[model samples]
Target chain A: MTSLVLAALLYATPAPQANVFTLETHWRAEDGSDRAFSTLKGRPFVLAFIYTSCPGTCPLTTAKLKRLDAALKAQKTPLPMVVVSLDPEHDTPQAVHHYRERYALEHAEHWSVFVGAEAALRTLTQLLDFKYAQNPESKQIMHDNTVYLISRGGEVLTALSSLDDSSAPLLEQAAQSEGKQR
Target chain B: MVRLAALAIGVLLSSATRAEGVLLPEGRFAPLFGLDKGQRSFAVAAFRLDRRLVTEAAFAAFLRSKPEWSSASVKPALADERYLSQEGGAAYAQAPQTRVSWFAAQAYCEWRGGRLPTTLEWEYAAAADEKVRDASTDAAFVKRILTWYGKPFRREDLLGSGSLANVYGVEQLHGLVWEWTLDFNGTFMTSDNRQDGDRVNALTCGNGATGSARREDYAAFMRYALRSSLSARSTLANLGFRCAYPATEERSP
Candidate 1:
């Protein structure tokens, strides 16, 4: 505790915020195109993680994202969305594409599905505080099904952990945090 | 040229010694909480682990090399103000570096040419006692480990890097501070964290796919509970970490 008092004296204020989106986290799209999350800078977006073969909550998570997107469009202009696969080993580009199709999100404007190496996914997960686990017995990946809404400046506006939570508040918060050109 | 080659090997050997890590041969051991409740044995590739919990001094040196990781430099996004508090000063450097965020711990391991051990690697290597490889079933050992959990943390108790080495010479897997696992969030015990909509069920009904392998291990259950309660940016007073590296070559018998 003494160190804390000394540290507080040494640091009168907290450090400045860091950019959440950077060119480092690159993803391979269903079309085999690679892009970093930083490429979406100056654009508000939502990020979700799922896998095609997941037997548990992945499908329900996607459906919620769908509703969220629809709600956002109904209120304001549609925002950009990206659904990443937590099971990158099984979630090939083709698998993500089929998964997107399974949700009837085909050609959904500003919404893209991408798959990449676990290394890249790991970096993104770190940035977003996203956590996932694979069960050896079930061969199924378990993860925190949470969606991160990022403002134009790459600031995480809020995180919705429960699927039952309303998207209206998150969209409203995003609306307030968007596009001042950081 | 012979002398020069010998000097190069000397430097390499000395640097490896400075790191003070021990190798655990590749083997299979049941995790405290396996995927199923049966406690079936699973294979874990060999790896190296630090002999002791990382000290505040060791972490401060790392921060000096990478100021972006410094408590003063890391933003609120990556870490909260609690990243390095009063215990962050030079005087306390000899103590175990607690209240470290998981991201910071991961970076420290990487900086040292290692990474945090996966959940299984940690549990497997920790199962060893000084005399036997898997001493987890021993009633005395199990009780001793669980007893550590019951004791409340005191500043006097956590102020050092000293911990008894296990059979494999890995130290403080249980009695010391709670170390970070590479896959801390990988284990499932509480609920389906991935599921989105909760309104329909709201009554604790899961799809029945997820369950712990060793449900009786209350100590492991507490470990998972604590881990699940934390986020990547968390910096708790009693939470610290050590580094682990992948085992590249087999140790000749």
Candidate 2:
């Protein structure tokens, strides 16, 4: 109860929103090809980080993205999803290809899996204020289970930890915001 | 009267420690051959699993002894290699195997001269303390414990130790891997001739919401539907299992 009260107080304090998304970051393709996000040329993008081997939270996270994709498609929305792998060492182009196939992610024009060197990925995650700590002794990483929503113009729109059907309203709000900016 | 009731509740909440291997009368149920008049007509057997979870070393020996059994496929994402290590070599094996399918777990028990305990038996063991399911205990007690001023002894990083064992020596029946039981398809509400491990989606059905469950776990007829939705090959980072055997002596508590 005390923690909840403290959290509410902290939330009330107005903190300036930081520019967490950088378009210059290089991203990899499901085919093992590398390219800069700037090359995508200002197309609105939704991004999430995941490893295929995770079953607990990762699967649920992927399902959320899938749900979001379906919602956008139903509305004929143009935003695409960019999935970056945290386990870059294992998630090869071929592995990502397999994952895409398994998840029926044939929506290639709307989705892409990116893999890069460990340091590059780590730097980007840190810049975004993503918290992931590897317990060296246990070889396990404890990370905040958050999904980042990024706009094409390199702005972090929102951070979502729980993705349910109720998020459709938030999606609509974001879409409206994007329309106003255009 | 209120004070008396409060004292009774307090005493009920924290008074008993489970005796090792002494099967409490209601501690377990025997598997039945079939049902009669809505009650399982078959004689319930006494199944008291080992006091400790089968260690990695023991499972490793089983795998080595029977090369025919398929081992966990090695992947870069998989951190633990020793699925059943006794000495705790690496944390991967120490954490417990999550992706193992129900069939594969059953195979391990058969190889080890035992069988997996039925779901009823497993729950009985977990409920060894009569108040185990009573959720009315004060959360303030937990908060009070955390505010202590003196040095406290704490066990760290050990999975399923003997301290958590039940009266019949069954450890970690809850909050661990959702064990695959022999009676997989039995209804939780009333006894029926249902398939074991049958999967059904019942989220839309008006059965009251369960205490937080996996979203995908929502299925079947009013929470009585069995889980067959999970892929047999898929393993999760949180899943681990234990095996059980029939007691040598047919002594009823």
Candidate 3:
């Protein structure tokens, strides 16, 4: 009888709130090191999804990231920027390294590229509300172009949806967050 | 004692059979939307689909194992306030589990060692009727589905409800609850108004579908609209999901 009561109480108890880092997905960085998403906690960061082979939008996205990086660096609040591949099977470590070199992000200290299994990628995408689909026959990927600025606690602070959208607001928020940390 | 033991074994055997689900054969299908320019039909791979919607009893068992998905425990980011509104009690045990967000449904399917069916797979399985596998073109069949869509929500026991099994032995594909698909958000890219610049212009201009494959497929259009309107965490009182698995090799009899 006592055990039954205990079970009933346990059943009603609430669980912890879910955050982006709470998802148990692992990824391989361009440097060939495997790590979980939780390891990136303790600071604000920029996150976006892209495939190295995307003929359209990806180039523009990379340019936007570079601009954002420059803006942040100018402000002296340099935050790490993570670009996760939408097509994980194609974005191997070598492909990611080549991509970095092609874009001249090879020596950028604050930039990281990651690739993971499709299932893990899907889990993270779903959590972040990023939409993407891959056509099997054409090997083309259709995806959203939203870029997220996440808080140190893993909440999405801001999202920029278009390539033309200015990063002024995002820069302001990051600077504020960095100020808070100091 | 012997009779009880026999009953227990029978129960286990039946559940094992049910766990295998129904295998759908690979085929070419023209879905309502998402067709590439000049593409008529796309090939859908063979997969195993759950015969019925996930029941409240089954979801309750899932919650027991993963309490973080419970309505009280779930974060607002993962599920809305209406998540699992009709959750507990034996009254809802046999009914289709509703008020579940797509994330929660996907989690449950993953826990079951399967995944949510893609929008294409769900539409393919739902295209069936009592006799024909692809009754989507039949005017009467389309009208029947539209009628269900037009009706208001009401709680009903799914087990003996008039929703008969389709040709593939899948039940309650329609006339029950709206289901969550694996890639629900991927269907209509143009609907996302936040997009601007050359990408949006390329999609909105002549590149993507100017109109649906068959304009008469109003029911299919409604389904696509509902899917596009929903966020990943959005939950309605009549939304639920079923699992789909990769098909294994068929054994010779």
Candidate 4:
């Protein structure tokens, strides 16, 4: 399955000797930057995918991300955030920039939004094994709404859904797991 | 398309037959099982599930109408990359979508010119079978049939969707996702002193037809428990639903 390859790319780094990181696969950032997953070399990243036009779950998802962020900040363990635009053609950098600002996600360098071509998006999506579909008539997309937790070295720690309320706990667990290793 | 057109015309012609106007039987409560707290007096439709679940194609059409609400709209729940295809992504749409919160379902139904089914109506319809005369007694057989159909029976022909519709011609009630109804507060096991007027009506009809709910009178008992366990903010993969409307004279355009 494409998910296996994508999972390998996400969980396995560019080099065997390299420290592990997650969600840093070949996917692009909002500025159209495409580098190896190693781009996020030293920061713990919380990744979520979304489109700007959605009014249903996306806003709630962002709110949950913010809640997680706030929870980490309250504990003084704030990490970087990454919001990937699933609707690349429509959700541009400007739109992402606006969304981030609207959601008050502008202060952290560890935070950035990504958009890319359909092929690249598909490749990253396949690597991550995230499920989504574009409708034929309305051209709307249906997808899973889970956020993936990636380590500083680009290794996928785990995924959390709003239903599970696993965002903050998953990140804390990842940090704790990484701390024990160090 | 012709068959669909004929079905549409048939639905138009039989509007009066589906009216939920009958009064409740004695010793029962109103049909609005879950949302009895507020002033929202929801109506119930006495129908059965169509053998086939609603398909991904049918739901995609719904998504198309409400383009603003994509899976991507919510960034952190599940991976939301598939945007407009019918491959692996179709499974989530194909399975009864559970993770859908009550708010989202209501919005979807509103967009489609219908509303979510009432808890009383959903339980009544789901628990009823063709041979089971009493609504109270039909629960066991309905549960058995649903369990049987839901097992590893993988025949594509078993979907029996548009063809083998239920008594009221509504499709895919039982085996789809546990449907969202207008009643969120109604749980399957909660004890309430309130009387359901709709169940009383169903019992009266069963009596008139010489068939009665045989197993037990725990009709309202089961619905209350299920409704209480549901959280308003949760969505799941196995949770999907069909919309309902009062069988009134006003038609959907």
- What C-alpha lDDT do the candidate models reach, one value each? 0.70, 0.47, 0.77, 0.49
Q: Judge the docking of candidate 1 as incorrect, acceptable, medium or high.
A: acceptable
Q: Write the per-residue lDDT of candidate 1 for residues B1-253, one digit (tens) a residue.
A: 9988966764574365345778888887877654454447777777888777888867776786789888877757666668877444666666788878777888788777777888888888777877898877777877777777777667667765444788888877777688788877655543333354432221133332224444446566566666655666677777789888767633322
By DockQ thresholds, what CAPRI class is model 3?
A: incorrect
Q: Is candidate 1 or candidate 4 better by TM-score?
A: 1
| Residues B1-253, model 2: lDDT tens digits | 9988966653443121111233424322222211222442123346546444444544554565565443554221111232222233555344444445444555566655455555555544543432342111224322222232111212122354322544444555443334455434332222221321221222223332332222222211111222222222223333345666656634322
Error of 3 at B18 (Å): 5.3
Best candidate (score: DockQ):
1
Ranking of predictions according to DockQ? 1, 3, 4, 2
lDDT tens digits, residue span A70-170, model 1: 88877665788888878777887677767867888777868887777655676577676566767654667767778878777776777887776767778
> Which run of 10 residues does model 1 chain A get worst, by summed lDDT?
A1-10
Scored on chain A only, each candidate's TM-score is 0.82, 0.78, 0.88, 0.75
If both were scored by DockQ, which would come out higher, candidate 2 or candidate 4?
A: 4
DockQ of 4: 0.02
Clashes of 3: 0
Where's the lowest-lDDT run of ten residues in candidate 3 chain A? A1-10
lDDT of 2 by residue, A71-174 (tens): 77676665778887777767877788778787888665778788875444644564454434332222234344556666655566776644443556547755
Poorest lDDT segment (10 consecutive residues) of candidate 1 chain B: B199-208
For model 1, the stretches where C-alpha displacement exceeds 4 angstroms are A1-26, A29-34, A67-76, A100-109, A116-123, A126-129, A158-160, A170-182, B1-14, B17-19, B37-41, B86-95, B150-163, B188-216, B249-253
User: Model 3, B53-159: lDDT tens per residue?
Assistant: 88887787689779999888986777766678764478777678888887889889888778899999999999999998888889999999988777655566343
- Name the lDDT of candidate 1: 0.70
Q: What share of the true interface contacts does each candidate keep?
A: 0.31, 0.00, 0.18, 0.00
Task: Report the candidate with higher lDDT, 1 versus 2.
Answer: 1
